[model samples]
Target: MQNRALAAATFSFVVAQSLCGTLADADWPQWRGPSRNGHSPDTGLMESWPDGGPKQLWIYKNAGKGYAGPAISQGALYTMGTQGEKSTLISLDANTGKERWTTEIGDILGNGWGDGPRGTPSVDGDRVYAMNGGGHLVCASTQDGSILWHKSMSEFGGKTPNWGYTESVVVDGDKILATPGGEKGTVIALNKETGSLIWQSSDITDNAHYSTMVPANIQGQWQYVQRTEKSIFGIHAENGSVLWKTDFPGRTAVIPTPIVFGNRVYVTAGYGTGCKAVEINEKMEVKELYSNRLMKNHHGGAIQVGGHVFGYSDGVGWLCQDLESGEEVWSEKRALGKGAIGMADGKLICVDEGSGKVMLIDASTEGFKEHGSFTLDPQSEIRASRGKIWTHPVVINGKLYLRDQDLVYCYQVQ
Candidate 1:
């Protein structure tokens, strides 16, 4: 009788463990969340923190060495990192800091700033898609550390950019899109299931940049919009034909993903590149609305709420920029230092890259308002001395996830 009771208890525990990361309702299945806009659809979150910060649920210190954030899906948290020579994909129990599995994708792609993977894995039903620093794209099983198929971006005549391959491959229905920057083809789509070539942006052969592409629906027509070093353009989703292109000279490196709202597409870069918004019509014509040094977001990613965009703008600090007009609503440097940002439930979640300071602020066009803030303890000491906390904060399923190289923190914000 005692043995039977113990067996039943063990089975019950297994069932509960299996249900942890599978809650698709609030899962962050891809980069920049489900919409790729850095906005979480979660609600009922705490309007303000009590004191230090929301309760730190747990911290997984063995996240390996990487600056990438976690992608939560199906009761699991998916991410990548490196130990020594191998850059690997790691899956963890979302509710706990325990690692479920790890798969070696390839050798570590060394970089001056940091090493290991930079792109977050895009999780689909049972599979997760990710790109390594060496420009290898792998489609693997989310259930276990098993590779279904792997392909190198160089196979399509694409070369790694200065900062490495950081663009999270955009996955649409039945297809996966990636940029192999160079004269060969800027953007290429492949069969998400079989890894077969679908089409490449043949006419527009520009080198790949470090920004993720966003899917746009212009007047009921389907298209993909992206920003490169030299230009911002849109391509047909079906055939990968260039629909419209506009030259916007980008300085240094253009890291932020292009923002799309209604018919307007906005692009911004660091090193005084500033910001530019262009309007595209259904006729595939492009016209510039405004360009200025208002929100020169380096990489922390700006989020659009209502009619305002919020991000950590260089020089100007955390800024709120108007979407329709390229004007600064407000800029506050005292609230937080320049870092990666995210949004959920009408609040801005920002982490200072230099210091491990995490802040929660009101996402308002009126001005910068702080609710509460806290500094990350037990941060990654293994990180490089010159390294900054470059990983963007991700909030999903009423929880907040942030990374400092190998250290991953989970907090209850709701």
Candidate 2:
């Protein structure tokens, strides 16, 4: 009897362990991926794609109109789009691309490029957060798309930018951080669970641009680093106090999120404005290390791999630059048109916005070398006349997700 009891107990324990392992989430829960650095934690991906690109497993139509990316967590995918007369939050099964739920968040934003949300939905545990282009912010339940709490950026003195609110709010710890740029504050931290105000950064009163905030621990001090059209600054994550401020000659639009490497912060912009790097010490002192036009990344987003930064410069084409020295490593101008980029498994997956062409290349400092390239078929006929395939490439859990207006294609990449 004692031997039988021991065997049963061991069997139950093993079953529980197996269940937990299967349910564990491998997710890209927010904009710019899990770390907001455009890097994927996934490994064992295809080092080189087949001639026609990775096999397309499924295609999800009716994602609606938006440049927003998808956020995958807990087996569900979340994104924003215009469902009808209103901007809507959408949830779908990550594996099968089946519609789960949709919740209207705000009025549809009208733009020449397209009409829809610009920010990706951010998923946090059982809740998800999204900001429509109309400056309306909503926190919704991840399961049924029920709105938990909702707030507008206008309540915090935020004026919608000319292109609309394109920020993907950062949910750090117990607080949700957002930029509602005005005289009242440039940044605000709200209670994630209740949607109440915590604190606001009142010192820097700059107008909000399209960039998102990145959290960094500098010399043991945790803060949120953000960039505006005129400045790059850091605010204390706890009280929203201004920690450091530096000048950036950003013009036209500053659309890329600031990249924080060690104690150094790097920012880039488009429309003739270039890139710059600044170092912040423990004492909160700021010093500019280098500034140049080597990386005039428009809105495609930039990623840092080791000590080098890679992105598509407006006129310079796709290039790699040393993060610290600001020296150009290598550039390829004629290979691909201007587009967004993402990284996975030590490789770069780049998409050309003009033609919906996808390319897989080695993320190497030696030079630009293409591993594989293919153009997206059945491109959207409803895309704005001015809008190309503007959405960035996202790779997670062996699947590659790409969007062209209402069409969301899933390809097996592992």
Candidate 3:
């Protein structure tokens, strides 16, 4: 009877975890943490760094020529870069920063800014998915880095954009979603296990941009929200049907991932396109809440903490904007230069693109208050002349990860 009770209790615990979407261990398994919101689900982190900064745990200096950030899951860190003539997906020990294995993605992508991949890897269960700049997507075994399946975005009628394919694929349940934007479809859903086509968003055929797709559950409906050069839209998860879309006059590039909270979706871009927010109703109606130039974030991603959004604007420096009213809360231009932003433990981590400087700021609406700051030691010498540090920061498991070209630095933030 005791053994029977233990079995029943274990079963109940598993069921509850599945229903709540809880994992046994903490993981930053994709582009922007678990939810792709530039927020880490980590607590008990150091609120302020000591004098200089957090303690450097390890620095693996051979990440290769790419701006892709690291994705960590189950003690393994995954990222992509270029090696010789091929783009490669690499896995490293999350604790010691030791190389574990690597698999070639495809031919190397030669671009003016840099010559390598750009999209981060997405780890789901025991399989990991990654994309090269040339639109080669591959799924491989997480344990051995063995290829399970592969596909090309060009096969789905996608035309390579000026910047290449920089969007990380979304893995949700049984489907993996990608934006291979063109006339045939804007987004394509494939069977996660077999790499077979599930469906495509045929209604909207905009060119793909650099932003990644975000999955949201709004109005009790599951959908994937994405931003392109022309519009911001949501597609039904089960089918590739377009639920709603709104026009966005994006310029040179629309690079930031769309942020979805509750029933509202917020998107921003650089090149003076500005930012906008729209709310979706249960009946699939879309209403633009506000549109303004308060946050013209180019590539550095934005984070939403509480009711405010924090990021670097083009004209303005580091700034915080009210998400509800589309107004500037505060601006701190001299604090940090244009770069990426991430959040953890009630604080914001900001990086400077020109110099590899990292700063910890209060994620508050009152003002731009910083707790600590540090610059990257031994910054990459092989970095392109025009390529400033573009990779976004990732914090999970009490560690902060930053990448500059081939140099990947890990700091103990606990």
Candidate 4:
């Protein structure tokens, strides 16, 4: 009887351990969360902020400056910044905000807009991927921040964009995809383990811009969609074949990544440019459904939830537009000035650009409903002379993560 009881307890322990492992694997492993659409599968998050906003759990001052955001996975947070002239990648303990390790990858390049690294580090399983403004792509180990492999975009026949490599590397299956923007090809897929070029998109060569690659299945086929200065192209994810192309009259700069929903794609850019919704047919043909300047989302990417797309539309203010017709449902320029935004539990988390105030609003088509607002007190040292809060806010596992240059503040949203 005693032996049987002990056997039953051991079996239950093994089952519970396996369940926890599976849950941890479902975390936000890379940029834009698990789906690369800025949506977190994390539930049980605080639906409303406290009166003065949730308590700041901790702040790590070692993180340098630039607009790069934090990538959380396996109990660790990865982000990039610059100290002096060298660009460094730092990893931190997600629960305690303690430094795990830091690695100097390359030199820092500055533009009129900002400085340091502008792209988020992608944490893939055992490897952490980061890109510097100087066009250096480094893949390091998650355990100790040791360099696994490194490659330069310029050396691989890609030119650095005006604002640097702001596109976060996308890891799909065994390959990592990036836009180098040169003669080799606009998009290239590299072996995630060995860092060798597996394939490059054929001669649709155009200069790289600020957008990241988004993976989606359109009409039962897997495709990688990206927007460049010239046009938007959907490439076959398996072999990098140009599936379809649509000309976008983007002016000055094209920064935001295209949002894909089913067979339709929505794209937007700032600086007098506008937004458009395009449909992809079964034969790989592109047709514009609606094009308008109503929601000119600058560099901040919009999210499609329910039936409306929510984002800050350049000079038009924070707006929600119909997913099919491109009609504005509501515009709230008076509520929150111009800035980037993200969605958490069906709520719009808006970060004001001019000021460091974060606002929570209802993500609805009815109108703008402000729930709570608070200024990010005790800002980072590196953010003293920097531009507005440029990094998009991220919410995961009931925690709110915001960045100002190198400093990252983690708050308990629940």
Best by TM-score: 2
TM-score against truth, every candidate: 0.93, 0.95, 0.94, 0.94
Give stretches of model 2 more than 4 Å off.
1-24
State the C-alpha lDDT per candidate. Answer: 0.88, 0.92, 0.91, 0.85
Tens digit per residue, CA lDDT, model 3, 303-323: 999898999999999988999
lDDT of 4 at 376: 86
Give me the overall lDDT of model 2: 0.92
Worst 10 residues of 4 by lDDT: 379-388
lDDT, candidate 4, 294-358, per-residue tens: 88888667888877899998778889899988998988888878887888887878898877789
Off by over 4 Å in 1: 1-24
Report the C-alpha displacement of residue 256, candidate 4, in angstroms.
1.0
